[model samples]
Target: MASEKTNGEQEMPKKKKNRNEELKLHDLLNDVVSPILFPEPTNSAPLLHRIKTSLSRNAPLIPQASRNTARDTLLWTRAGSPLRPLLLISVGTITILALTGLLVFTLLFLFATINVVIVSLLISLAAAAGCLAIFFACVTVIYIAALLVAIFAISTVIFWTIVAITITTAWIGFFYTVWLVTRKSLGFAKQSLSVTSSAISTYSAAWGTRNLKHD
Candidate 1:
């Protein structure tokens, strides 16, 4: 019985040491993988009800200083002069009004500035687009003009080539006609000279015969 009691006390301490030292990997994994706001209790409530419950459960705790300040202010208003409370209320009201006005003016100014920026951006985009269009149009016009000029130049070269060929042919025909006319005129002149010389010879021979017969 004494040995059993000693063994039991030793087992209790060993069990406690093991329990304290062992890390729960499964619980850590579950918390990391699927964290739950209220893990033990499964909630199937509507969205608004769930939101209200969640907000209530996590409500902020008020500090004691705020309560003391409130208490002091209440006491001051109750026991002090009525004019002091009235003046404080008036000042607070004026401050709130001024802050509200400033907030509204700031919002309006921001909105107007944003509108102006947007308008300026749109105008800039339009001007850039217009300039791009004009540039494209000018390029197209220039391309067309260059094409027409090239065509005109080609046509002028062809026309001049044909005109030169025609003039060359005309000159060749004129030179051939002049050569033929000169050859025909020279032949006629040689034939006429031969006929005249024969006639003169015949007349001279007959006259010499007549003179001898008379003698």
Candidate 2:
């Protein structure tokens, strides 16, 4: 009986040791590989260390003050130019006003010609009735016909003359304005280009000198 009990005791200790080894293996797996497979937060030391190291190694290159200065220079240069907007607004306004005036004049002249034709026709009819019994009826008819033709011709000439004058004047003004604006824009562009070129040359020379000194 004693020998049997001693054997049981020995087997219990062996089983306990095996269970402790298995628990230790489970703990090791949970620490090293379980997070990859099961997404459970056991510890964050490794992740935090990686983040800190990355931030320390790769810092931002440009300083804040230099960045602000570059932005301010761009803004100031843009703000200093006033002629471009002014030219655009002036040209647009003039074009619209000229077109409107041309349209108004055309409509008014057309209506006036119609009214003149109607009045002349009414007067010719009245004279024809009054002179129908006279000996000069035929002559009167010829005179009235000629008068009507002349009136039509005169009205047509006047209308066309007005139109031609208006169109020519508007065109002349438009072209002159365009030429002036173009010349101004070209001058501005040349000046801007010159300034940009000068700035670039200066920066390049300074950079070259800096590099030479470093060498």
Best by TM-score: 2
- Against the reference, the lDDT scores of all candidates come to 0.59, 0.60
Name the top lDDT candidate. 2
Where does candidate 1 have its weakest 10-residue lDDT segment?
57-66
lDDT of 1 by residue, 1-215 (tens): 99999999999999965643442434333333332344335666665665565445333312333444556667888896445565456455555655655565566557655755665565556665887656555654665566556556655655565566556655665676687689889998989898988998999999999999999
Score every model by TM-score.
0.34, 0.36
Deviating ranges (above 4 Å) for candidate 1: 1-139
Clashing pairs in 2: none
Q: Per-residue error at 24 for model 1, in Å?
A: 99
Score candidate 1 by TM-score against the native. 0.34
| Residue 118, model 2, lDDT | 61
